[model samples]
Target: MSFPDNTVLQSFPATLNHRNATIFTANRTDSSAQQAIEDLIDARLQLRDRVSAPLKGMENDLFAKSQPLDSLRPKLRVTFGRAKRDGAFDWPVEEVINTLGAQKRGAPVAGLYGFGYRKSALGLIQEFFIFTEMLDGHLNGLTWLKRERNIQNLIHVSFNLLHALHSKDIVHMDFWANNVMIDPQQPTRAKAIDLENCFLTPTDHLTEVLAFQFGFYYRREIFRFVIEHDYDRLVFEELGKYDGIDRRRFDEIYALSKHENISRRARREIFHKGTVVTG
Candidate 1:
């Protein structure tokens, strides 16, 4: 199927599951949108042939036979399949569409290149494909940061992204260290990924949505530590043992995260100020 005019293709290598659907990336000579779709179909065919006669325990290894694709620019290709029972894609198609919307709206996210789907003999949708920019040379926030400056920079970047999303009334339901990726070359800039679970709501619901996310998400412990002591102690006294981020500024982050009105102007202030570390 021909994709929209905005579609562009590059190459990357990765294999992972999206719900029950299989997603993988491969290289292709053609950069056009239609050619990209055909490349994905060819990759799927190759995957099927390999899986048809699996080696011992190979079925259990999802990353088996994964190989890197060659390209000057890297792009991600995701494929989604339908479940037999529900006759629907294993994952929510709207999630991918919403992510594209987020990217277009200036949210810190991977750029969406294009998306298309395959249909069955009866014209029913059988599969879905999405193409996006590959975040090359990026490491998640959980990875090691060799310098105190790098750590401080990541914190600033993360909160700035959070505020950006909140300003659009979008709640990153799974905001955490691993969801934010940074490149050493651009230490202070980060991009958020895994936005499939993000939630959109009215501006008035922003604080409540943020509260819910905090209560149930991975970084709830950060707030707990902050309440018991303070953002400073939580950073310098506790987490400093791990990352050595002591003396690094976090006041703006603390104020934004702990503010009663989380989506208020404070977030805008921090975002507009372009939080950066000095000294």
Candidate 2:
């Protein structure tokens, strides 16, 4: 049996419920059997749910605005449902490309598209880009994680996974909370998504402006999403945990996060460090 490479597959539709939801077409697929299970874990963590998780009357209000997908140069169709059956494949194509190293058409996918773990794991959510505007107060996680420390696990997993990839020389151009997903119940291990704009540095060390930009954005998102999201929780969670627990955890998160210190400092070394700041 030979699965031909570079074969452009046509996507069909699967049933989904958009009622009282935000701007999105409800479809699922069957070919994404592997992703179904992976997405299930991600859905469990509620990363995408938090991002795309429609607001109260989000559907009613969404149509009022417009987006890139509204006119829709090229739209991706879903082909599976979460509740369809015991087994199904109905996740986004970006997810497919991440874990499966495949594509439906000539459309681009994230750099981590083909990067994934051995078994089922989460992937980034790309569906949010097709919008006129993002909803307000995605910072709602503050309220959700209020007075709880477990949420740190989610933050930890989301941030660290990207750092781990960066350590491997993968520069994730788009490093945002929305682009990462957490594995259900396992906050230590998460998945990175949206490689369409990501680039893997051929050389171990990348010394370009793009690397700096990627690092800067990655740093911003990690600080904003990971540390800020549940810093207090993590702090207390590590209370009496160990002598160097915090440092160890910090290193772990840094290793897994997509923000690379190398990428961040590489360009600066060439441009500003040596350049004299004349008064």
Measured by TM-score, the strongest candidate is: 1
lDDT for each residue of candidate 1 in 189-211, tens digit (9 for 90 to 100):
67777665564543333333343
Count backbone overlaps in model 1.
0
Superposed on all Cα atoms, the candidates' RMSDs to the truth, in angstroms, are 13.6, 15.3
* Model 2 whole-model lDDT (C-alpha atoms): 0.33
Per-prediction TM-score to the true structure, in the order listed: 0.49, 0.33
lDDT of 2 at 143: 33
Question: Which residues of candidate 2, in runs, are more than 4 Å off?
Answer: 1-156, 167-169, 200-279
Q: List, residue by residue over 1-279, the lDDT tens digit for candidate 2.
A: 001222212121232222112222223422342233234333433332323332223432221111121212122222111211322122233333222342222112222111111111222222321211122222222333442445454455544654565555454545555555443344344455444344344333233323333334445434554554355344334333223233443443333333444432233232333211111
